[model samples]
Target: MSTTSDLGTHGERIAAAYLTDRGLRVLDRNWRCREGELDIVAREGDALVFCEVKTRRAVGFGHPAEAVGHAKQRRLRTLAQRWLAAHDEHAPDLRFDVVAVLVRAGRPALVTHLRAAFS
Candidate 1:
C-alpha cells in the first residue's frame, strides 16, 4: 500500500499537470511559510492561484474536496496574504483552487479541479 505522503505527492503531480494542460502556468509547488503550505501556486492569465490538493484511495470518507472546509478556507486565505507579502510581484487577480485526486490500483487516476473554490 502506498503511504499517505506518497499518495499526496502523486496527487500534487497529477494536479500540476492537469492545471498546466488547462492553461494555468505553474509557478511554484509546495510553497511554505510560517503560516502553512500552499500545495500549488499558479498563474492563469492575470490571476494568481493558490491550490490545495487532496488525494484519496477511495470515497469511503467523502469526496476529497470536502476536506477543504470553511476553516481551511480561512487558513488558505491567510497563507495567500503571507505569500503576497513575501513576494515582490503583483497579481491583479487572486483566487483559490482545489484539486481532488481519486487513486485506484491498476487504473488511471481521476482528477477534479475546482477553480475559484473559495474566496
Candidate 2:
C-alpha cells in the first residue's frame, strides 16, 4: 500500500484499539453502504458511535481532523443509517466522532478523539 493509505489503516487500527481499551465494543470497521464509508462503528454505553478516522504523516498544512468536511460528515451519517438497516440494529442514539492521528518520524503517536464531532 502507498504511504498515505498505510497511515490511514494504521490510524484506524490504533483508534480501534484505543476505543476498545475504553470499554467500547466495536461492531464493525470500514462499514460501508452506497452512501459512503464509516471508518469505525462501536457501541459506547447504549448509544451507537460512527467514527471517522483521519490520519496524516504530518500536519504541516492542516490538522488531521480538518480532512473531514461538512459533506463528508453528511455522507457518514447516510452511511451509518444504511449500516444500521443492513445489520437490523435497533434505532438507538447515534453519534458522530472523529479520531485524528498525527504521525511524525521518531515520535509517539498523537491521537485525539473528539466526541459529537458532527450532528
Candidate 3:
C-alpha cells in the first residue's frame, strides 16, 4: 500500500478480478522465472493470454499502458515462451494484453484493458 510494488500488487488483484468477471479464466498471477515475471496469464476461449498490469496514482507522466514499450513487450514475449515450456497448458492462439489501473485517493480504481496489445 505504501511502496510502488504494493500498489502494483493491488492493481494486479483488481485486474485479475475484472478479467474474471468478463469471462477470462485466470490461470496464473505473478508468475516468475529467471528471465522475468508475467503479471497475469489467462485463458479466453481458445487463446492463451499473457497480460501486463501497470498501475499509477495519477497520469501526470503518461498512461500506465505506455510503460510497456517495445523492449518490455519483447521481454514479455520471451517470458511467455518460458512459461509455456514450464507449463502443460496449450492453446491455438496467443495474445498479449495490458491492464492499466488508475487509483485515486477517494474514488474506485479505474481499469482499462487493452487486448492484443502487441504481436
Give the best candidate by TM-score.
3
In candidate 2, the residue pairs with backbone N, CA or C atoms under 3 Å apart (3 or more residues apart, or in different chains) clash, namely none
Ten residues in sequence with the least summed lDDT for candidate 3? 1-10
Question: What's the TM-score of every candidate structure?
Answer: 0.96, 0.92, 0.98
Better of 2 and 3 by TM-score: 3
Question: Model 1 over residues 1-119: C-alpha lDDT tens digits?
Answer: 45999889999999999999999999889989988899999999889999999999999999999999999999999998988888875789999999999988899999999989989
Error of 2 at 80 (Å): 0.8
Residue 105: error of model 1 in Å?
1.3
Ranking by TM-score: 3, 1, 2
Model 2: what TM-score?
A: 0.92
For candidate 3, the C-alpha RMSD (Å) to the true structure equals 0.5
Residues 11-112, candidate 2: write the lDDT tens digits.
Answer: 899899988999989999997666667899999987899999998887787999998899898888788878887896664688999999887778878889
Candidate 1 residues lying further than 4 Å off, grouped into runs, are: none
> Poorest 10 consecutive residues of model 2 by lDDT?
84-93
Tens digits of lDDT, candidate 3, 8-82: 999999999999999999999999999899999999999999999999999999999999999999999999999
